[model samples]
Target chain A: MIEEETNSRREFLEKSIVGGLTALSAASLFSSCHGDDVKETGEKVKLLSPDGTIVEVDSAYINTNIPELHLSEHNIREGVPGKKFVMVIDLSRCKNARKCKEGCSKMHFLPKERSYVKVEKMQDSEMAAPYWMPMTCFHCDNPPCTKVCPVDATYKLSDGIVSIDNNRCIGCRFCMVACPYSARIFNWGEELYGLNDAEAKAIPDHDACSSHKLGTVEKCDFCPQMGEKNELPDCVKACPNGVFYFGNEYDDAVTNGDETLQLSELLKTKAAFRYLEELGTKPRVYYLPPVNRLFPFKDSEESKNS
Target chain B: MESDFKKEHEKLLDLTKELMPQKFGRTGVIWVISLVVIIAIGLVAYIHQLSKGLIITDMRDYSSWGIYISNFVFFVAISLVGSLISAILKLTHAGWRTPLTRIAEVIAVSAIAFAGLTIIVDMGRPDRMINLFIHGRIQSPIIWDVLVVTTYLVISTLLLFIPLVPDIALCRETGVNPSFWNKKIFKFLSLNWKGKKSQFFLVHKSIRILAVLIIPVALGIHTVTSWLFATTFRSGWDSTNFGAYFVSGAFMLGAGAVIAAMFLIRRQYKLENHITDAHFDKMGKLLVLLSLVYLYFNINEYLVPAYKMKHGEAEHLNDLFTGHFSLMFWSVQFFGMILPIFVLISKKGRKPLPAFLISIMVIIGAWFKRFLIVTPTLLHPFVPIQNVPDAWKSYNPTWEEWSIAFATLAGACLLMTIFIRVFPIIPIWETAEERGIIVDTHEEK
Candidate 1:
């Protein structure tokens, strides 16, 4: 069922990108050179354009690389339909290895100095036992950040993901102030790592929502692009100890790439609780307490060195 | 009897000459030039900020707001003086404020204008500023702040202009025009105040109505500003007392600003006869009462949080009381609130020079007090500050931020200087009426 949904969504994403590519081709054809009629050659390179057309291209012209689909600016707000995405982090499995953070940063093309997901050493008080808490956007149902945004730039979608439209964002930072979790990070300068021309051009329909810009806020987006490919989020895939589970509540299943579990059964068994529950934020992410932790809490050598 | 009339006419002419807007002397030229240079530099820095983004400032994920916000708060605080002196005083029948009303109103107008500009300066994408109006959500406190601030600015401008019409006419009609530009402005602004009995009645009635209308709007402006922070759930911001606390503190700062402006105008124009020792004494008493009330709110804001010390509140309170912010916290409380109250409470301290000196201290203290209110609270968010660059952990504003903030300050001063250059700082007709000296305008006509 999950595979079928993923394939159909992938087809939908391809159609949108193909529409964008056709517009691109139309512009290029008007300005420069491109053939109007389809032609076949002995090379017969098969090309599956996002538009869902299986066309024959010369071997020299065939570009097999399937770049991430950049949806239309409007569709970025719609999210994946018929989905209520949720994350469950089993605290007992985390030892602050930071593989999850590394994978998340690499996948999101974030600057080295920042991460979408952070592994924090937390102690409720001086007397409480210390534990590693990997934190990111709660994607809260009652997102304080979205509520205070005067421009409606950040919004909670029906599918339980709160996202920002950078083009619409005025960079007032009021959303940052309203958020209790401190999940949002501002792009203070021009994007440090510029995309290569080919890569940039590949995303013909780049939604301003997914694009980061100077003076805008950015945060974890649950790797919605990866989800379209029937893959778990980067953090879920990269966790060496299977600490993170990403799934849809509608599907009633979550997978850590290695193991899949029923969302209700796992929560019932683990007695999962959301962070700062009393704040009434109604977070989409849940946490299992650090009961029977895998490794005794110790300051990691990397954190100490830094 | 003919010789006596000639002497009275000469005396009135001399007084008018002394008070008329004079061309900038060498010192005034230098002051104007310096202000212009500073404003130019600030504009350059702001352009740099626009191109480079807010990353040029030291703000990060942890301390999201820095000096730009604090500078905005200071501007909002100082602007309140217009309402306090003109509206509150006029409503209460304290006619002694007549000389200082224009000065207070000018400060209010200029400060509120810059308050609007400074908030834009703080925005990361000022290009998208139109979104605030177009996509403005009434659910947000920011929308409320925008609405109230714009309302306050409009009302303050009208308040300043309505009272200035008769004075502008006086300047124009009295044959004391220093320049052609002065003549044109006074002629345009005067609205033909013919000194008819009916005109005075109309002017008096309009001023009365506006004075009554401004008080609630003035309160609304600062209350909405406080709501910007108070609506958030951050440990330092989640206070029910914030609205009243902000209002009381703004009143104190506004009074201090008016007192300082009064002293400078008195000395610069040598209008000691018009300003008077009695005016200084009355303002001193008012300052003391305002400072005491603000001090009570200060106690209420800090003491209750300190007592409860809920884990989040405890860390934040400790940071303010005895931790990193202690030095600033103590000094602002002392110099801004406590010292001013102590000095103004005593009879000797109510003298012009001492009162002026104390008022200056209070105003300076109040600026830093705003900084303390904004920056320190932001540093102590619910989540502990960690990860990212070490620079993000503690905020210290960059030179670009300081330049833009200082430029706004210079801009406000320049506005005041230009205002006084064109129009008389003190009301001419109102003062003459109070002293039972009817100016014989028929001779000039």
Candidate 2:
């Protein structure tokens, strides 16, 4: 029964994103044809128009094409349904390279100092060896953050993604306190990222994570915009060591960019566990134990400063 | 018999003359102006915050809450005195509470009004406040707080105003040098209170119903406020005992506030006859009892958790007990709780002047105590702090935050000051009746 509901929801999301993109491109195409006189350099470029037809246009007439899909606000909130997204971090494989953090920051248009992913140096006890743990929002099924939100600004979606509506958020910071993982960050000031107000507003809402409204709470959203295109999250794509895996739980398949694996078999064989599992948050992200050393655990310059 | 009746009537008139509202003197004027100045400055700072964002405050992502929240808790705590002095004492049949009820209710109304405002001041988008009502979730503790705070404010205002009807009538009939607007307001608000037997009976019955109603609402307001913290999974805040702990501590703070107000009002208005040494003695005893109860809860909240020394809890407790927050922790405990207990327990300490001084200490201590509850727990989230600026690890409130916090406090005081300037701070008819002077509003002047 639940699967049927999710399938229909997924179809609706796809239709809306495609519909929005078509309208957007049609408007832009009309403006380019009428609003400005085309100076054709006669260098032909084959482009797939919004209707899926190949058309030749002057290279000079081609502005960067609109993103392939533009999920409306309603679609973003409903999420790409029928798939329970999950992530696995193989602790033994991390070498503190921090490419995942860099990639995530770049994709979100976050400032150099702000990042959704943090590569933490963690030591369990006196004798246990320390390891690098890159942390993001756990997207807990029993999300304490969403439960405490007075305004329903942050909510858990059908696709196992915890999302935020900055437009609706009152910026109370209660959710920041409720999340045991310290995963949330606040837009304490105006975050234009050097863009003027008009420029910032011109960026599509789904893609404008960096220009978040002042005083709202924001965190790792798992790159739902990318998910619409069947692409992995930036962190998953950027890891050099294959330490991160992205997958659909219902399909029982998880994949690094290089290798795909069965989820249950991988967990059973590697002794996978969730961070702070005893809290009963039921996190979707799982971690393999740091049993085997990949490289000697050396403190990164960022870790030392912190 | 006729001579005796005339003599009693003369005495009642004298009592009314003594207790009627007075014009502000030079000191009063200065106090009001200074509060206005602070409020103006705070308004400017708040506008700056609104435009620039909460970045003006030193709060980073980790210590997301700061002095604004602590100030909110303090206002909520102090406001609990309304139910303590008026409803609780009245229900308990404490006649000595008569002089203090007006003061307590005024404090409750103003503090609670500002408490609501302070929460807005803390919000990142004060413009989005309407969303709370529109998209409110009943499951959220913040919604619970809003509901209870508003209910308490209404009940408290009614509690303050209902009992003042006969007094307002008395002011209308026989006020000395009342301003033209004051006379008009008194006449409008008096609701034709004639001091008839039926009217007295109605007033008495209404007071009784409201007195009962306010107790549960008062408890709910503070309990819901505490739940905002207790519902969180943080080590320091995740205690089952938070409701009782918060209630007891609030009562202590409220008692301390009442004592301080009693001393200052008595000195300023020369109301030593009404707010006497004996009243101070009783209130001092009440303060000690409340402080002792709060101290017991304090032990439960801290000691048991410390005993377990659970990994997450241990880090948090260590920070409070002997680590970074230790100095503030110990000072608040000693000066705010322990020292007040030790001092107020003695007979000399319960005297008017000494009790007043200790109450001041308690009020100051209680403010910092709230700060301790909010900030320290946030600093020690379950995950270790890493890969952020060092400033994110510790919270230090900036000038803008301080100014805004002080403005709220000043705003509350200004409310009470304006209330006192306009209305009698003590109920005239009630005081006259207690002294066996008959009050007949229908009698011709």
Model no. 2, DockQ: 0.65
Question: RMSD in Å for candidate 2, one decimal?
Answer: 7.4
| Clash tally, candidates in order | 0, 0
First chain TM-score, candidate 1? 0.72
Q: Compared with the true structure, what per-residue lDDT tens digits does model 1 show for residues B1-445?
A: 5566556545555556667777777778898999999999999999999888887889988889999999999999899989999999988889798888888999999999999999999998998998987888888888888999999999999999887776676677569664787777677788877655567677788888888989999999999999889988888778899899998989889888888989988877778988888988999999999998998888888888888898888988898889988998899889888988888889889999999999999989999988988888888877777665677777899989899999999999999999987788887767776766554433433
As a whole number from 0 to 100, the lDDT of residue A219 in candidate 1 is 87
Runs in model 1 lying further than 4 Å from the true structure: A1-74, A191-209, A228-230, A301-306, B1-18, B437-445
TM-score of 1: 0.87
Question: Whole-model Cα lDDT per candidate?
Answer: 0.81, 0.86
Relative to the unseen true structure, what is the C-alpha lDDT of residue B380 in candidate 1, on a scale of 0 to 100?
81
Model 1 interface CAPRI class:
medium
Q: Give the Cα error of residue A75 in candidate 2, in Å.
A: 2.9
